[model samples]
Target: MFQFLRKVLMIELAGLNRFLLGQDLDLNIINSEVSRCNNNILADLTNDVLSVKSKFADYINIKLGKKKQGEKT
Candidate 1:
């Protein structure tokens, strides 16, 4: 079950990656899957996915020349 869930998350992340590269910024699917993982007691996996998602967001922001509030340049 854990492996299955991990694979599902990986697929979702891949989709997100494609969208991110295309500048789509649609995170609904990944966000829902992460929440589902958390509710299923997969805390570690959830954290890992969240970390990757954060990195994706950061990359998108960098590509768009957007800076986070209070972030030092």
Candidate 2:
């Protein structure tokens, strides 16, 4: 699933790159859509990483009780 998503993203990026290099395509529309898609992808990835980190931290604190000194949970 992840690989397929990555592949699609890569293909879209490549298409944008080709357009930038003077490919025979509608440059204005491609530029706008590609920029939007890239931004959305980046935001989603950032959110996913932060969520995973938070979950891991919770697991560690609950299972191992490795809270730092002077920290309250």
Candidate 3:
């Protein structure tokens, strides 16, 4: 799923780069900005997934009558 998202992002960014190039914009600046934006987006996405996975693991533990670390019985 993450790979798919990365591929789509790459394709979209490529198109944007071409469009900006046609407008005579500085490709280096555009690429740097895009790279920063892409890194931020992916990092946020990873954090969100980790949070959800943690919550799901807690849920499963509760369902199985297991105590999470440092969790009260």
Candidate 4:
């Protein structure tokens, strides 16, 4: 289901976030593996940040009354 996939994606992303923060920018095989499992529900997992972006945008706009110079959210 969507919820289960989202939970798995979140766990994967937590690990991925650590790798990225540690400067381990090499997700080649990982990318391929995930792509191989892609589906509509899985695709939503990838757009997770956009959800965060929309939330952040609303929060920032409400607080600042406008978008910042180059802010995405």
Best by lDDT: 3
Consecutive 10-residue window with the lowest summed lDDT within model 3: 64-73
lDDT of 1 by residue, 1-73 (tens): 5577778867866665565556544578656654665465556777877887799999998866655544656
Q: Give one digit per residue, the lDDT tens place, for model 3 in 1-73.
A: 5677668767876776676567755778877877786687668777877887899999998876655544765
Cα-lDDT of candidate 1: 0.67
lDDT of 2 at 41: 79
**lDDT comparing candidate 4 with the true structure:** 0.64
**Candidate 3 Cα deviation (angstroms), residue 27:** 0.3
Q: TM-score of each candidate?
A: 0.36, 0.56, 0.60, 0.34
Q: Over the stretch 1-73, how does candidate 4's per-residue lDDT look in tens digits? A: 4577678877876675555556644577556544554454356765875787788888988877655534756
> Which is better, 2 or 3, measured by TM-score?
3
Worst ten in a row by lDDT for model 1: 17-26
In candidate 4, how many Å is residue 9 off?
A: 5.8
Error of 2 at 11 (Å): 7.4
Evaluate model 2: give its TM-score: 0.56
Q: Residue 57: error of model 3 in Å?
A: 0.4
CA-lDDT, candidates in order: 0.67, 0.73, 0.74, 0.64
